[model samples]
Target: MARCFSKLTQTSVRIEVGGGRSFDCPMLPVSAIDEFDGIREMLGSVDKPETLREVFRRLREMAARVLPEEYAPGLARFTLDKLIELVAYLIYGDDDDQPAGGQAPADAEDDLYEAKKK
Candidate 1:
């Protein structure tokens, strides 16, 4: 069935956020992905952006629900920066903010997404 086939594409990704903090986050369900992209598109269309906090808060709440129990306390200790990093890692597998090895700080590139679009 198409429904079951789509579900097969979803799976958990495990990320270690240093300091012994790690979590397994499942890929966003199709409905959640629709909502995610919708909110993003709406924000881009808006002249004065609000509800940014609500958007990230909803993501954090959803992520928290699926996180392993071992890392529950760590989630409580996460600052906004760390939470965003976790979210990015879950979705993209690596943080774009972090410079790659052997790359000079000034030479580091942030063009991965652009390259993917080609």
Candidate 2:
């Protein structure tokens, strides 16, 4: 998807995604740093936006193929917001309050035993 924005007083903006997997956008001018910062600050407080949902969906699908079935089910239930938090923490070493997706490693074993009993 690609979107362009131009306002009366601001510079033109262009955002583009190719192959639904990558971004190809023009770099903002150095003078736009404050404007960019303001935009980021405003966006940071918003709930996980729909624009991110598709990316998270693709990531989850990839993880499913590599993860064990027991873990896949739990991971499939994660919201885009949770995925974002997890990735951010992994990449930036930031502490996110949410738990990582996938089955609890130990609990999966317990579940198998409980299922056999039933």
Highest TM-score scorer = 1
Tens digit of per-residue lDDT, candidate 1, span 1-118? 1111222333455555588664446644444555555655654565543565565565576556666666656765666556656654455442222222333222322243346668
Candidate 2: worst-modelled 10 consecutive residues by lDDT: 8-17
**TM-score (all chains, Cα) for each model:** 0.44, 0.27
Clashing pairs in 2: none
Evaluated against the true structure, the overall lDDT of model 2 is 0.41
Best by lDDT: 1
Give Cα-based local distance difference scores for all models: 0.50, 0.41
RMSD of 1: 11.9
Total backbone collisions, model 1: 0
Error of 1 at 31 (Å): 2.6
Candidate RMSDs in order:
11.9, 21.0
